[model samples]
Structure formats: C-alpha cells, structure tokens
Target: MEERLPGADRLPVGRRPSEGLRLPAPDRALSSRTGYTRGTWLAVADHLLDSLGPWFTPSGAQVRLPGRGSWSGADCDGLEGYARSFLLAAFRIAATEGDDRLVERYTRGLIAGAAGEWPRLTPCSQQMVEAAAIAVGLHESRAWLWDRLDGPDQQKVVDWLSGFVGSKTWDNNWRLFQVVGEQFLASVGAPYSQDDIDSGLDRIEDWYVGDGWYTDGDGQNFDHYIGWAMHLYPGLWTRMAGTAADERLTVYGDRLRRFLEDAVHLVGADGAPVHQGRSLCYRMAAAAPYWMGMLLDASPLTPGQTRRLCSGMLRHFVDHGVPDERGLLSLGWHHHFLPVTQSYSGPGSPYWASKGFLGLLLPAEHPVWTDREEALPIDEDDQVRAMPAPGFLLQGTRHDGIVRLLNHGSDHAAPGEGEPPADHHYDRLAYSSRTGPELTADRIDNHVALVGPDGTSQRGRIRRIAVDGRRAASWWKVGASRIEVASVVLGRVEVRCVLVDGPGGVTIRHGGYAIADQQRPEATTAGTWAQTVRTDRLTSVVVGLHGYDEAGVRLGLDTNAFGPHSATPYLVRREHPGGPVLLVSAVVLSGDTVWPEALAEAIEVEVDGLRCVIRMAGGPEEAEEVVMDGGGTPAAAGETS
Candidate 1:
C-alpha cells in the first residue's frame, strides 16, 4: 500500500509514486539522458507543495516547518517557509498559466501576513531576505494573485516591502536582494528607490573579475553564490521590469552567457556540480543560472544542452535522497549532515533551492522542454581547461566521470587579511564533484602545510601567479615564511610541487582526497605511497615523488558529508630544514582501480634547489617543469621533453 499525503489523491494523474513523493513518468523520448520532462518538473513542484500542507500555521500566515531555528528565531524561519516556498509556487502558477489552487493557498498567506501576522521587515533583518522572494513571487504571479487582491491588502503588502527603501544590506550578494525587492515594488507602483535598485546592480560591477566571474564581495569570495544569487537575482529582476531593463539586460545577458561557458564544464558526467563554497545545502540551486541563461536567451549552450545540464543536476540530488522520505529538504548535502550547513541555515533555508525550479516559468511547449537532451562536455571526452579569473584548472576524465578543480585562487578571505584558519570549503588546494574535504577533523585533505609548534599553516588569501593550460601556481605565507605551490594535471593525476622558505625542523604534510563511506574504507600504504578505497571502488591516492618520507592513512569518524566513516591518505617529510626546500607529490581521485606502486613508478620527479621537473609515463602531458623565482613564487616553465 502506498502512503499518501492528505491531498495526494488530488495530485495530477500519471504520477509515479516514489518513496515519499509522487512524480510523473519519465519522458524518455524527449529527455533520453535524464528522462525528466516538463511534466516531471511539475509533478515535483506539486508534490513538494502538497507535502507542506501539514506544516501551515492557522490562517496560513506561516508554514513553520520542523527543525532547528537560525539566529533569526522562529518568526523568521516561519517567514522563510512561506516566502521561499511561495517562490516555487509562483513559478509553478505562472508557468502553468494559472493554477488556482496554488495561487489561493499562497494568496491567503500573503494577505494574512500583510495583515500583521508576519514580522515587519527591518534593516538588514532576515525578513528583508524573505521580502525579496515574496516581492518576486507577487510580481511573477500578479495576474492570478496580486491583481486579484483587494486594494487594502495590496497596500498592506507594499507597506511590508517598503522597509527596503532605506535599509542597507551586506556588501556581498545580499545587495541584490534589495535590487530585486525594490524593482518588484517599482513594477507595482509602490514606493521604491531607483537609487537602491541601480546602486545594487552597479555594486556587483566592482566585484566582477572578468571572464564572467564575480567574487561574492570585496574579497576573493567566489562560490555558488556567484550563480544562484548573484546572477539569478539580476536576471530575475530584469524579467520583472520587462522593457525597463533593456540596456542592463544586454550587459547582464552577455555576462551570463560568458559565465555559462565556464560553468557548463564544472559539473561531472554524473550531474554533480563541483562541491566548493558555502550554502552547499541549497543543492540543485547550482542549476539556477543555466535556467536563467535560457530565460534571457543568453546561453552558449543549446536548448538541448541546457535541459540536459539542468535536468542532470536536478536528478543528481533526487538520486542522492534529497527531500528525505518525508519530502523535506534538510540542511545538508545528500542527507542530514549538519556540518555542511552554515550558522545562518535554518530548516527552511533549503527551500532556497526553489531557485532551481525557475525553469518552470517557461511553458511546456518551450524549446528547453521540447528539445531532446544532449551530451555534456564530460560525457564525450576528457578535458583540461583553465579559468584565470577565478584561478581554477578544471580537469575532467571521461573514464572515471569525475571532475576536479585545482584551486589556485578564490580563497574566501580579503587580500592582506592576515593568516586565518583554513576554511574546509574555500581554502583547500582542490575540490571535486565526487569528493568533499574533511570538514570536522584535524587532518584535512587536498592540502599541503608546514606543521610546527604553532600549528599547521593555512593557505590563507591565495596569491595567484599563473593559471595556464593544465598548470596553475599560487603562494601563501606561514608567518615570516612563504610557501609556493604549482600543480600540473594529467588525466586523473595532479603532480604538485611545493617550495618552502621558512625555519628548520618542521614537518611538511600533504593529504590526498578524502574518501568516505558508510563503512570504514580500505586503507593501504607502502613505501612513500598511500591510498584509501571506498566499498563502491572510489579511490583516493597520494605518492611522494620527492622531498617526502613516510606515507599513511588518517581515519575520521563522522567527519565528512558523503558518509559517516572517512579516510585520507597523507605523505609526510619529517625534520625538514624548510628554507628553499622543494617537495613534489602526485595525488589522484578516481573510480578506476589505482595501483599505488604503478602510479609512483609512472611519475618521475627531479628537484634542484627550487626548480623541479616532473615526467609522467603514459600521461596526457609529456613532461612539465616548474621553477621558483627569487620572490618565492612558482612559475610554469612550459612543456618539457
């Protein structure tokens, strides 16, 4: 017998029941790759909305779903439930050309909340954030909801949103929330500051680093916010403003088009987006920009490619058990792992993923829905591409179907901010679609540090020297000393060469990818090489090619988001007299079987002072040489034979 929600029977017919929710049958003819048609998206939207029935408060003022509250308290969390979900409901109702049920349900909440059941939006308050979603919802569904409301109710709603007229937001992507909220107000003939809207849109120009990348703020704070919030809101604001956004639309559209060119390669063949940055709990929100690109007709991807990419990402999360059995989006990746969430993440925060459903705004007959799915970049061949603006070297292997990002820049710290503790998400030397950094342990992965009496050095505020071809170079400081690193990638392997200019008697430690599983991973070490293999055969390997001694594995319990038990392979050089010493190693993460000895034997390294040459047999590159100049910065010396 299938367990059904109170309104499950009223859901559309042809609904294919899953564990706790019902979705439509796959349309394999149109979406052969992901089998997720427009009907599938509609079913998901309706299922999620229907699942929220029991959580609505009396008078429909707030939904107030279960789970812990954020720093903003219960009132704000309740508002989040109503506002965020309203965004999804709005997309659904608008795209369907009007769904009376959804409109009426959210309309009651809007009216009651405007009548004072909800908290007033204050300066920089969390309510201010929810106000943007509410404003956008009202604008998108104006005909069915806002226009149908009585005059007094409409003014009450405007009164609540007028809180943004003089309120300030954080300098980061929060600025765009004001732009979106105020623009919607202007569209509806309410009190709005054009200055707030224009300034908020103009402020992002300062953070744009070209090549379609923008740091979240003044710092090197590049992350998912660049897409989900930064690009998503401005594009949405343009839609609400219609022809009023003509000039800015041209600029924003070009920027988004260029951004999709790079972002398209970031997802793995299996549809997982690179897991780097904050707010990862928003899961599929990474797909928001791709949809926006389609909405604005600014995408480099074909309609087939856009649908494939977007549907692939949406399916990846669904396959991983997002919206758990109870059909709730928990504050974690894949499952309920809290460490991946931020302090600001309330239970309803995950609903921000409603941004991904923006595709629903397009009608079923749209090309993005009707087009046949196409292959992703990773699905066809291996790739090695460099994005200099963000200082990332993207490597994708067709065989393993995994994509790795070698991070040479984009540390979530301001320049000259001094050395702070390493952020597991943003400060790692590498991140991938298939692996996550060990977030709750002393032993970190994808990192190289000089360990001394003070502690292991952090890769604070990366100073990027170069990012070209398959190689990237950056340097960081440990007190008075400097550590420079250059990485050359070939297939699934990354050969990292490090030069340290510091005191003596310190231990240099380097860790490989962290592989996690429900059970303890099989760990092995032999003669300067180490590897950990999960039961499903995903492997993380590290080998010391030069300036290192012993190899080992570190076990971590409940320290990873992928699973409960995790293992990291590490190599160490003891009693190092750190001045001008160069260390070289090869690290790998793949789904293929990796023999440690064969990997170590395939790579040869030669070090002379601060200059190092690395050669890999049967690798993509023939040979590469890296040298450190007098300033202690690594530079690639081009390909060598």
Candidate 2:
C-alpha cells in the first residue's frame, strides 16, 4: 500500500501557474481546481503506445519506429527498439491506476518477448541496455505480471534477463545498465553477482565530478544522460535493492540532491530544458532526473515545484507537436529532424521519454499530487550559476526566463585522442533553453574557428580553464593553431577576447547564435560593426564591439538539428598579427522585442589585458572590472538581482 500524509491539500500553490503552462495536474485523487488532471498525460502515453502497432513484427520481437534510416551500431534495430519501448509501456501500465485493455495486450507482448518466444529477439552485448530495462519493468510491475506468471514463465523471464549478468557493457553510463539489471536479478532471488553489482556501483561513482555533475565517462561526455540515465538509475537501484542496500541508498540520496540543485536551474522559463548534449531526440526524457528525485525522496525541490518542472517540460514538447498528427514520437527535437539523432539511436529510442512519467509510480494521495504547483528557479528570478564540474556558467534572464549556458566545458570528443574532431553538440561556446546547436559540420555556430588559407575553418576540442561568475575561459587547438579565449557575459552580451599562438597568421571567425529561419528573415547590416537577422519566432543579432575586422550574417545550410536552416551572424578578423587579439561581441536572441537599452553596454580593456571592465546600461564610471577568472568561484557572486 502507498503511504500519504494528510493536509497536503492545504499546501499553497508556490506561484501562479505560468501563462503557457497548460500542464496536467499532479494526479487524479488530488482534485485539481482546473479541469486538467494526470489522465491527460495518461492519454498521451496510451496514444504513443497505440501508434506503435504499425511497427511491431509478427512475433513482437522488434518494433521499428516510424522512421526511414537504421543505426549501424546494432545488427537488429527492431529487437532493441521493441524491447526498450515495451519496457516503457509495461512499466507505465503496471504503475497506472485504471482498467485499460491496452495494458493487458502490452503485458502479453512483453512476456512473449521476454520468454524468448520471439525467435527474432536475439541477445547481444548492446542488448544489455534493453535487458536492464526489461528487468526493471518486470520488477516495477512484479505484482501485476511477474507474480501472476506461472513458474515456468517466470523462469523464462529470469533466464532471458540473466544475459546481462556477465555481459560486456560500455565503460560509461552503460555501467549503470549492468548495475540496475543485477539489482533486479537480486530482487527476485535470481542468480546475480554481488561482485558485479558492487563493482558497477563503485565504477559509476568515478563518473561523478562533484557539484551535482557526472562526466558520463572519463572524457568530456557530460549531457542530459547525467540526469536521465546516470542519476535515474541510482534511485531505481535503491528502490530495487530496498533495505538490504540502505547504506548505498544514503550515498545516492545525497548525490542526487546535489545534482538536482544544478539540474533544476537548467530549465528555461518557457518550459524548455537546456538544449545541449546528444540524444536531442529523446525529447522529454530530460525530466527523468527530477522524477527520479521525487521517487527516491532525494530532491531539494518542493513537491509542487517538482511536478511543475516535470509537467511543464512535458507540455513544452507537446505544445510543439512532439507527437505528430499520427500520435507517434518522431526522431528529432520537436518534430521530425533526422540530424538530431546519433548513429546509435533507432526509432524506438524516443520511447525513453516515457521515463518522464515516473511520477505515476507515486500514489495519487502523495503530497506531490496534493501540493500546489511551484515555480522553477529560473521562473522565480534571473540568475547566473557556475558549475565547475561541467565547466559551465549558467545565465538565466528574468525578462525572457531563458536559461543560457556558457559552456567552457564538455565536448563529446574524447580526451588524449591526439587531434579529436569536434561534435558541435557539446563543443558549442554557448547553449540555451530556447535555441539549439548549429549542426553544420564545418562552419559551426556559437564557436570561434580558425580559418585556414583556403577559407575552410577547423574546430578543435576546447579544454576549460575556469569559469567565475559571468566570466569563463578555455583553450582550444585549431589544426596546429592554439588559441585561448576569455568571455565576460551579462544578459545577452558576451565580451570575448582571443589570444592566438600558432604557426601562421589565421583568421578568427566568431559565430553567434544559429537562429532558426524557416521563413524569409528581415536582415540588416551595419558595415563591420553589427548584423541582425530576425525571423518570426527568433531574432539573432551580433555586434562587434571591438577587434573585429569584418562582420556578416552567414547562412547555415540544413545545419541546425532543431530546425531545417539557421542563420549565424559571425564577426571575422583576418591577418591576426599572431599575438593576443581581443574581440568583444554582443549576441542577442529573443522572441520579444530587442531593446537597444539592454545592448548599449560596452566592454573596455586595458593595455596589458590584465583587467576588463563592463560598462553597464549606466555609464563609464559605473564600469566594473570583471575578474577574468572570477577568482575561481564564478557562481559565488550570486544572481545579479
């Protein structure tokens, strides 16, 4: 039976529900004054499940999502895809409180798949991820399915899931896959290696980089996976292990609490989560960490605030046509855009978004449902926070409620790989809650590139030096060229300075925001000083305040993962004269009116480059010299209220 504390209904709504947040209420039992209820989300989930009927194979072994291409990583796409989606469907169905015929049908399909009755459902090393999902799903619905199954069927399920016991998993987040699978095995009194469980848990701890962040692996692989998979698993593992692992549960609780503190700040006021990292296609899975925190009681957020963040994020995608007219989740950020997916991502991969519905596991009477919805940190005020582990300085704007991440850290490119190629997903100089990375392979946005003699620019892996308050610095290699850059950001303005030490005199191409432009853009240029391109929903403008020899609006061809085409207004300085070159540019992105008053600030630099001053909307004397390194603690300066 689920436990609940009375008087939860008396809890105040932390803040008025935002303007566009048409989210479902926490649950059904807790009567919402609005017509909205958790049933709305259930309907979406059911529709998603029903949409898969067209893709299921004869034996239900594989479910190819309605998409064109297949990933090369797996020999069989349908098997992994079907298993993963089924795991989600089964888990949700098991936790749901209602009489739904679809649930029974899905449960039967999962049983057949798990029992290996589907000859096409072959086991492989990559299947370890799916295997864990299946095991966890069975555990989550143990009373409804696992316990009801006959001895032979239960053995079949156990025998099939046992494939992960001694399997070879990837070194990174894949470690958690093994750990969760083993935890499930242990829960059922089945054969599981305690050594495997202990070692997997210990190894995952190595990925933890403090300040509520994990590297995903040894190199710079930080992304949503930290919240969706890395953190989500520990909570699930704790619940699966129960009292037997109380000591480890305490450790996980503390770590998860710390992580949520940072994670909550990443969401934008518009309900969009930070649009960095890979698997941009797993649209709503970004909410998994918050939901997991709720599940484990390890979060710092109030119950209402947790529901608000999770529900708001889900509604954000839903409002954007995530489930197309046919009710199918596509392989892209919002609608269908193929570039958003990695090679390992298959059609069924998006089903991982079901992890967002983890709150369904909580009983309806729980305070999370009874309490009033609260505002996110970004919603409450404009703020800036520096997360050292990820090498990011987070900036949240009060007017727009958009959270921008100044990334001095995180690149998908592995470390020590002689010369690693840059994946624009993680290498971008900045990412926001509203915009996406410019996906053009060569000419990337939100980046500083060293242009060769042939005009083709090269991007190198950037190693972070420090981030203090609104200031951040990093070093990157462009071919044989080595460049260091420092940025002092306030609102939309980022004053940047680049120091070059290389073999040849190179051109520095500082690209700004990659604003999505489906319609014709109203473009304006002011010689080499500034350029502004405005679409209906987005406006990208870049002003060269200093050191830029030329500035122009560059169009990226099918270069954005979020949208089809993007326009980047970049400032270029040629014939670098080889030494330290300072380029200060103001990049502004807004759906609202672009105010000149906010952009009028100027950056002043001294001869030695020792001190940089930001003259705010006020005057020169009000000019405050920003510490380039922020004295090593950037966020300590607190929000510029």
Candidate 3:
C-alpha cells in the first residue's frame, strides 16, 4: 500500500490536533462485500482515539480533573488502559498516515505511569486489579511504550508485573482477566511468572463447561465477560509468552473456536450482547472475542460477519449517542442507564475498545480478510445449540430484531430458602432474558448476579432442587441459551415461556399466585417495592417485595400497591410450594403503541395444577404458549463506548 503524509512515521502526542474531529459519520454505510473492510477497523480505532483524546491530560493518566466530571468508583480505574490504548491505535493508524507522534506519546506516558506507581502498588492491591492495569504497561509493544521507557522505568514495570505471579489466587472473572492480560504480556516476552501463568490457566481449565463457555469465578451467572475477556486474552498471552505456551494456548484456541461459534449468536441484528453480570463498564468490549476470531482464526465467522458485528456495535452505541461532548466517553444508555459503570472504570478504561483492534495483527492477505460475508448465528431468525457437557441447551430467537431468553432448566428458589436481600441495582428477572449476565449490581463475594445478605451480589449458589418428589439440577439461561449449574436444594418451580413474533411485541403469562402461600399480611401493604414496565393496555408489573422474613413476623417486609395491585410482576416465583407471599402475580406483554387486537383477543389464562398457562387469543391452532414469570423491563441497560 502507498503511504501518505510526512509525520505518519510516529505519533506526536501533545494533544489532539483538531477538536470534534468527526468522520463522515457512519450512517448505514454498508459495504457491498465484506465483514470489516481493510481499513474499516483502523477507521474505528482512529475515531476512538480522536474521540477520547480530550479525556487524557498531556501527562496521560486519566483523572478527568474538575470541569470534565469528577472521576469516581470503577470509572476511575478505566483511565489507565484507555490512555495506553491510544498508542496501539496510533501504531495501526501511523503506518498509513506517516505521522506517529500519538504512538510515542502514549508509550511514554505508560512508562511514566509505571514509574510513578512502582513504589506504591501495595502488597495488598487486588491481584486482578493491579494485574490488569500494570500488565498493559508491560507488553503492548505497538507504539513502543517499553522502548521509550528509561531502563529503570522498564525494570519497575516488568518487576512489578512479575511480582504478581503469586500475589492472589485468581478465580472466575478475576482469574480470567488476569490470566489473559498476563498471557498477553508474557506472549510479548514481558515479565510474568510461569507459575502465575500456569496456576491461572489451571484454575480456568476447571471451569470450562463444554460447548464453548467458562464460568465467571466458579459460580453460576457467568456471561459476556467470558466471551470478551476469558476467550480472547489467552491468545495474546500465548502469542507473547513464547512458543512454549503454544500447546496450551492452542488447546484454548481450539475450544474458543467452538465457543465463538456458539457465542457469535449472542449478538443480535443490532450487535447488542445480552448484558448480564458485573463490570459492565467494559460495554462494547464484549465484542472482543471476534478480535480473537481474527487472532486464533476461529471459524464459522467470516470477515463480513466480523466487520458487520463490529460495525453494528459501533452503530448501536453511536445511534444511542456515545462519545460525550469533549470527545471523551461517558456512561449511560437512554440516559438513565449511565450508572452501568463501576468506580474501577476511570476514563482510560474505555480503550479496552481496542479489543476491536483484533484485526490489526492480521495482515491484509489472510483468509479472515478475504472471506466473504455469511449470516452469523445471531443473524439467524431462530438458532439453537445443545451442550451435553454442561447439560443445558442454548436457544436464540429474534422479535423486533431483539434477542431474548427463556430459561426452563434453572431454579431461583431453594427449599426453605428465604428471599435474597434487597440491592439497588440487581434486577432479579433480567438475567432470564438478557443475552448475557448483567454485572455492576454491587455483588457479594464478587459474584455477578447473586443478591447476598448485605444486599450485594455474592458468590453463586447452585444445587439440585427437588420438584414433584424428584431431584433436579439447574442451569443459567441468558436469553434462549441455558447453562447447566451445580446441584441445588430447590423446590418445584414450573416456568413456561411463549415467544410473540411482532414489531415490539411481547409474551405474557400468569403466575400461580392463587396458591395457599400468597396470603399477604394486611399491615405490610404500604411499604412494598415495585418496578414497572409499560407494554400496552397490559403494563408488565412487579410487586409484593419481601426483603427478609424472620419466623412469622418478617424482618424486612417492604410493601407497595402502586403497579398492578391485583397482579404483581417483580418476583418470578410468585407462588411456591410452601411460601406465603406472591410477588410476581401476572406477566403479559401488551402493546406499547399499537396493540394488535389479536394480541388482546389472543390472551387467555388457564389453570393446570401448579402450572398456569397463558394462551394467546389467536386461533388455538396458530397461537403460541407464553411463560409469564413476573418481572418487566429486562435491564441489560448498557452499551459499548
């Protein structure tokens, strides 16, 4: 390729040249041919770099000083990596522009940050926390961050990263990120202990559920982080670590091929991954696995699909309005979902968006670059995958181009189990319909979705539940797919779901609230909690929130009668074998704008033993079944920046 522009050789990073550098603004620009074209991803990288430049101080750490919006929580944690990423984008873009100053500046800043943090990273820093941050400081060779560092700064970063080998034993998501980040550093010959590397890999190996998925930590509710971080990071590690790690890396690479094959469907026509678990702050980085597809040559995904998938994500967020005014990235989608980020996510973190740069390492001639467009699984109208190893099935379906899940193999309640505590962010039923588990709900024991005693997410609790006198194991279903979980002590919960196919159409079903356990105490009516979703004449609703019950007198019984007083919608298990309160009373998806009279006419409720069937009024011959486990407005409320 012919090169142009004099300064493209290296980046000159003082501050971005021009502000508000908007490109032609991708407005439904479809390539007649491929996934991501030769320079499309590079353009994305450039756009991101240009868009985020304002967030970094010339010094390069992302404090977001006073006017920009005070940095807080995980939001602060994201700055380092994002600033570092400008170098990577600069590297890919520099070769074409012949101006490489951005590359040199970012690399220098990384070295400077390492030197600054060298004396401070305490023995007690969260293992994964520091590992993920400093690991980038180690490898990431594009703009030559290491080459620009003075000998001492280089040694400090290398030594600091190496010291992390035995610090904390990483498990689940932490281990997943640590291993992959370290592996990338190691792959590039950056300092990292072989023991730390092996131990991390060993831990991950234990959680690999066949059919291409890994459990976050060791619990239930593992979702997108696995696809984005777990499967993608190892390749970077093995590639950089030295050929000795190839065998293990290849094994991971192979399994990931299947996982990618299995997971590519999680993204719908709009490129949204069902948001499930924590640290959702990464947003669109969920598409990182496709980069792995380019890296590991994972099949069943063509260049067209890759390009479309990545671009679709870009469009989805941009359509939702990303890239805050100062050209900096901000949190929130539809405005209200902004808290989707964590304190760990400082301004620099959004650069994990560089995962989109997966194609950078691939030359212009590879098959990934040449392969023609093919429909991705998520692009399929209806798709299904069975996993015997995990003993569950994953199904993908689309309505209004929105993909959602219906989980049957999972159980939310256990025998004699009391309701979990209250949490500000945990939406109990969102997991049932999200493409992936939504994190960021302030968990307990670092688990993604579990609501612990303290009202924070806790480690997962999965075991067999006896239903109708027989023991039954369970799993997690984010959208149409199901992941077999560990055996749990559970009671009978028969959940049935029906898919309604129409623009903005939804399914509806009634919970068996008439059971003897649904008698509400007269005194608890005013304090109950409620979350509501508007679907048409039938507003999907939730109520009867019981925080904690102790003996006959409940310890925490909040009450409210605001939404759907007669039929509640929050709790999926409104009526159980032995409980005395029905939270989620009735669930039916009605029209938001245009209610198909058929939809209203097609709806009918039928009682069957402990199971209640919600049948559409449509002709019995053509009507479908609806599973109305209470809970409305599935909140995967996040988007990639």
Error of 2 at 149 (Å): 1.1
Question: lDDT tens string, model 2, 1-641?
Answer: 22121112322223122222223443433332222245555656766777777777765666766565454343345666666666667656665643256446556666677666533223345567777777777778777766777787777777877777776677888888888888888888899888888888899887788877878877777789989888888788888888977998888888889999988888886568889988888878888888788888899999888877776787677656666656667788766778878877777777788777777787767777668777677766768787888888888877777788888888766655654665767777888887787666666478888777666564565567777766778776655556666766666556666656566577778877777645445555664544444454466667666667877776666666545566777778877776455556667666667643246344444423534555655433555564333223222121110
CA error at residue 15 for candidate 2, angstroms: 33
User: Candidate 2 — which residues are off by over 4 angstroms?
Assistant: 1-36, 72-75, 97-100, 115-124, 595-611, 619-622, 626-641
Model 1, 1-641: lDDT tens digits are 32233223432233222455655666778888887878767777777888888999988879888887798999889999999999999999998789999988998989899889889978788888899999988888888999998899999899989989978998888898899889888988998999999899999999989998988988678888889987998899998889989999999999999999999888988789999998898888899999999999999999999899888888777766666667788888877788888889898899998999999988788899988999888889988999998999999999878999999888888654455456889888999998888985364588877788977777776878889988998887777777778888878888998887788888889999998887899999998999999887999999999988999999998888888889999999898775678889999999999988988888888888778877889864656778865363442232111
C-alpha displacement of 11 in model 2, angstroms? 36
> What C-alpha lDDT does candidate 1 achieve relative to the native structure?
0.85
Which candidate achieves the best TM-score against the true structure? 1
For all candidates in order, the CA lDDT equals 0.85, 0.69, 0.42
Model 2 superposed RMSD (Cα): 7.3
Clashes of each: 0, 3, 95
Question: Judged by TM-score relative to the true structure, which candidate is superior, 1 or 3?
Answer: 1
What does each candidate score in C-alpha RMSD? Answer: 4.8, 7.3, 12.2
Of the two candidates 1 and 2, the one with more favorable TM-score, higher being better, is 1
Provide the global lDDT of candidate 2 against the true structure: 0.69
